[model samples]
Target: MLTPQQPLGSGFGAATTTDEVMTGIDLSGKTAIVTGGYSGLGRETARVLRAAGARVIVPARDLSRAREALAGMDVEIAPMDLLDPTSIDAFAASFLESTPALHILVNSAAIMAVPELTRDARGYEYQFATNHLGHFQLTTRLLPTLRNANGARVVSVSSIGHRYSPVFLDDPHFEHRQYIPLAGYGQSKTANILFAVALDQREKAHGVRAFSLHPGAIADTGLGKYIPLEHRVAAGVIDEQGKPVRDPARQLKTIGQGAATQVWCATSQQLNSLGGVYCENVDVAPVMKEQPEKIDMADAMRLTGVVPYAIDPASADDLWELSERLLNW
Candidate 1:
């Protein structure tokens, strides 16, 4: 696989904040849509974007909570649930009716290490359905509005857990395999990267750029809420002390740190000529080349090279076709 990940020295690092990333940048009159903006990194992102002068719109499943989350902030909350096609359509349609230009979109919502085998209305495995497909349809539906803006950016919040596994193409919906939650989460994370690949390929020509990001680990993030405590113990992610174990698995970034990379990808002039790359902690990620068990990140800095099963163009096409059919788009 080709290694496409290269750092351009943007000067932002793991410690950078969203505000630092956007310093001196002006987003006035530009519109941004942040999914899951009511909590965690999403809320931090909205805060920085608003501070930087952008008009922020949050598409949240819970309107009441969203309002409270951003009270007194210059933000708008719209009702949209990724798993529900009607909700996504209604929200997108309502937003587009008022404007043709959209500048920034952050697909910053997801579940991690969920406990049960849940499915969406159309029976899509919940992880893949919500984390990947929902964002897929949302972005596709809003493509025209974004393209009209020129230089628009789309950010997909993925996870390093993508390293756990790729999309099992033949059994993507877990029809045959035993249901393992982390594996399901991994598939969805992998899809987030591939979605950016497909999206940037198609939309860059229209002046819209797409990026995928791994927002670090479980520091007070919603993703952790779904993780089973028993599993966490066995994995040594948490010890008898009920605190995170000292390992890469348990290490997490602060919410502000977690929001840095996507914000950087959104506004940094250093990335001015780049698109279609996966980033983490404010920089391009190295390509991963090894099979899940054998590959070390250093040996595989292929950020653009998601696992073959993950980035398979054929599978991507198949998934897109299925999503459109499911959403009735």
Candidate 2:
């Protein structure tokens, strides 16, 4: 049975840091792959997991930059571009040749709200292609290694931005409809959650559970680079001085706090039997049945629940099939 989309009273809250959630947990012999591990929340997560004794591999599109950013950290860096399918396949093949098992897979890398419509080589919308489809391809290719662990966790880092829109099954690539950056981002994020639901349902029996989560609005992550400064200030993510506002209660968080939930989802013993749940604030978020009305950033921050469409089982299955068809896998 699926875990209910509701909090389990996990003592941790929005302000919890990665170190706080990982206090007693040990990943000594575990192997983890954290995409986008060189920066932002992903970098913090990689640092903590490595400190916990896990062998963390950070796949980067830019090897030199990744090495520099990860300087002093005992983590491996490999090349893989999410926008390129060939690179993904090569990266997976290379990892499988050396690693016998993968205990944790955190799909934490993503581009948010690109200012204009962009597409991948496959001619698919860039945000959807890189964020959802690319990870979809990578994860599916790594299934054997994940299952070889006997027990593993795949954490998909989604966002509250999913509330902007569900997957557009009819025209996910914006081929027929007008392109809207947030909506495109929203569809990809929604796909991330639904992918977790579908993947967990299929892999839980094999001891490979999946999860998705919102890491809060972290301004420093560089995920919002495309959004204009004025818009960001309006969204309350940053102040006039261009500094991140720290308000855990409003879901605005520091790097450590923002990295907490995905790290928790990846390593917390509290989630041993739980999977396919959309989480926030370091716990399973309640499901909101209806799409919320248009609200400002402050109001949106106060709303932390996952929408039903994003976690619906049927929609998950549908997305799985659609993704498979699109990837031709």
- Candidate 2 overall lDDT versus native: 0.94
Best by TM-score: 2
lDDT string for model 2 (81-148, tens) is 99998999999999999999999999999999988899887899999999999999999999999999
- Kindly list the per-residue Cα lDDT of model 1 for residues 164-200, writing each as its tens digit: 6777766778889888887898889988887877777
Candidate 2, which segments miss by more than 4 Å at Cα? Answer: none
Worst 10 residues of 2 by lDDT: 289-298
Stretch of 10 with least lDDT, candidate 1: 296-305
| Predicted candidate 2, C-alpha RMSD | 0.9
**Alpha-carbon runs more than 4 Å astray in model 1:** 1-3, 230-251, 294-315
- Predicted structure 1: lDDT: 0.77
Each prediction's RMSD to truth? 3.7, 0.9
Cα error of candidate 1 at position 62, Å = 1.1
For candidate 2, the per-residue lDDT at 126 reads: 95
Q: What TM-score, computed on C-alpha atoms, does each candidate reach? A: 0.88, 0.98
